[model samples]
Target chain A: LAKTTQPISMDSYEGQEVNITCSHNNIATNDYITWYQQFPSQGPRFIIQGYKTKVTNEVASLFIPADRKSSTLSLPRVSLSDTAVYYCLVGVPSNDYKLSFGAGTTVTVRA
Target chain B: SAVISQKPSRDICQRGTSLTIQCQVDSQVTMMFWYRQQPGQSLTLIATANQGSEATYESGFVIDKFPISRPNLTFSTLTVSNMSPEDSSIYLCSVEDGARGTQYFGPGTRLLVL
Candidate 1:
């Protein structure tokens, strides 16, 4: 499993964009960059995933450089409801591949 | 995305007792996992529930403490035995969405050991 490093916390106001970067220096060639958003008392929700370059979805966008050492999750026009812990995970999507989560970046969206 | 659900959404159990959490998925999945999340802490992988074989546990977790059962592809159960206050946390189960290359998790079973 590739170890990921991300910020512990980030603060953002409504209507502003929030970007969270994650570093996975040991990422493998088969690994994919995935981000999950977890709200209080709920399971983590899949936000975006990408193997390289950029991938955009309705909720967020993922940008992975060519090196794949790091990636960023960009949330455009955030709102208070977006306040939650975001986890970045890098691994293959195999059946035996275990998903390990680190201390996620807690994004607090304020008014 | 698979719809996952867990039984006993929240429970208060006495120390030394055991509680079994059930996880159900809307569709058949090849891989099912159990995880523990301590209060204000990150998620920890407990084990991988294999359909026909014994579950594979992580380094810090054991079958004696966290017994797992995957009778079929869409359902599994986890039993927390001889619980302690330190075991008070949220237990969750997830199913792998191989097509999407991600996992969908259940609402999680909140356990409070007293």
Candidate 2:
């Protein structure tokens, strides 16, 4: 299984920064690091994806170094609504590529 | 960006009854995926629904329990058979992100078993 490891849960204050890191030591060459944000009672939404270095979008930014051993998701100036679970997955589908899911990091942005 | 939708936003069904969740994509897609997420848990890929072929289920999922159908490129359905309390989850459908090899999910269907 191409698994990922991250903190079980995290806490932050409103207008603060939140950074979640995921470690995938056994990631493959073709694997792409993708992050998703999931709220209560809702599905996971695509946040960002990066192969290496930094990839930024309107929602968040993903930083992946050359080693590819780990990646970080940065959410700037978070609000209470920004509280959600974040998942880091490595790899893409070609022939039933399995997405091994762990208990994602629950980020709570408190007021 | 693509828009994906799922039917039956929320449902409460008695045990032993079945529920079929529908997923529709605004545009044609190359690959579709089904996922199950329990309360306070991360998303689990239930199966990979391919157009014109059988659904490829994950390790713990069985086709008999979670039947998936991808009749075409733009739509798919997942049926939870012989439902139990364990079947209660947020069922979601996703499409492949062509450029980044990512998966974009729908709003999802929330199912609660009684």
Candidate 3:
């Protein structure tokens, strides 16, 4: 498992774009970057995942550079409801059965 | 994504007592996971529940403290034994989406030990 470091907290305003970055300096070739969003009192939800370059979905986008040492999660036009803890995880496909979550970055979306 | 659910969504237990949390997935899964989230803390993997075998627990967690059972593919249970104030947290169950390697979580069981 690759240890990840991310901002402890971030504040963003409604309608503004929010980007959160995670660094996994020792990331392995087989590891993939996956991001999850967790609301208070609920389990974390899958947001987006990527191995390299950029991947976008209905909810968010993930950008991974060639180095794969870091990745960014971009949320478009954020809303107050988007406030939650976002976790960045790096692991291999075979280890999909196990996941380690860090403290995560707590995004506070204010009006 | 998998639709997961848990039993006894919330509970208040006395010290030294035990509580059992059940997790059910809409479809069969080869692997299931149990996680704990303490107040103001991130989710921590407690163990991996595999069907027909003893669950593999993570460091700092043990079978006696957090007993797990995966009798079938879609259902599993985690019993929090000898509860204490520190054990008060949200317990979540998850299953992997084999195709994408993503995990879907249940609503979670909130346990408050008094």
Candidate 4:
């Protein structure tokens, strides 16, 4: 499993764009970079996933470079309800049964 | 996408008593997972339940403490055997939809062993 490092917490104002970047120095070739959002007392929800380049979904966007050593999760027009911990994971699609979650980056959107 | 559900949303039990947590998915999935969440901490993988075979447990977990059963692809159960104070935590189950590679999770069973 590729080790991931991220910020412990971040503060953002409502309607402002927020970007959380994760660093995985030893990312593998086949690893897919994925991000998840978890609210209080709730299960983690998949936000965005990408192998390389950029992936934009209705919820968020994932930006990955050619090296694929790091990825950024961008949340546009953040709202108060967007306050949650975000997790970044690096792994292949199959046989990687374990979903290793780190401390995660807690993003708090203030009014 | 799959909708997952778990029984016994929350329970308080005495030590040495076992609690069986159930996980049900609306559709049949090839891979089902069980996880434990300690208070104020990240989630940990407990085991993977595969249909027609024994479940594969992660390191630091064993059948004696966390016995899991998967009779079919749509459902599974994890029994906390000989529970202790250290075993108190939230138990969750998840299943992946192959087409989108998205994993859906249940509401989770919160167990408090005293």
For each prediction in turn, the share of the native Cα contacts (below 8 Å between chains A and B) that it retains comes to 0.76, 0.62, 0.64, 0.48
How would you encode candidate 2's per-residue C-alpha lDDT over B1-114 as one tens digit per residue? 889989989899999999999999999986899998887667788888889989888889998999888999999999998999988888988987776566778988989999
Please provide, for model 4 over A1-111, each residue's C-alpha lDDT reduced to its tens digit, 9 standing for 90 to 100.
899999999999999999999999999987888898988877788888899999999999999988988999999999999999999988876644457888899999999
- For residues A69-90, what per-residue lDDT tens digits would candidate 3 score against the true structure? 9999999999999999999999
Q: What is the interface RMSD of candidate 2, in Å?
A: 2.4
Question: Cα deviation in Å at residue A92, candidate 1?
Answer: 1.6
Task: Give candidate 2 regions above 4 Å deviation.
Answer: A92-98
* TM-score-better candidate, 3 vs 4: 3
- Candidate 3: misplaced stretches above 4 Å? none
Q: Per-residue alpha-carbon lDDT of model 4 for B11-113, expressed as tens digits?
A: 9999999999999999988889999998878889999888988889899999989999999989999999999999989999998757556577888899999
DockQ of 4: 0.62
For candidate 3, lDDT tens digit of each residue in B18-101? Answer: 999999999999999999998899889999998998999999999999999999999999999999999999999999878778
Q: Lowest-scoring 10 consecutive residues by lDDT in candidate 1 chain A?
A: A91-100
Pairs that collide in candidate 3 are: none
For candidate 1, chain B by itself scores a TM value of: 0.98
Better structure of 2 and 4 per TM-score: 4
Candidate 2, pairs of clashing residues:
none
Report the Cα RMSD per candidate.
1.0, 1.9, 0.9, 1.2
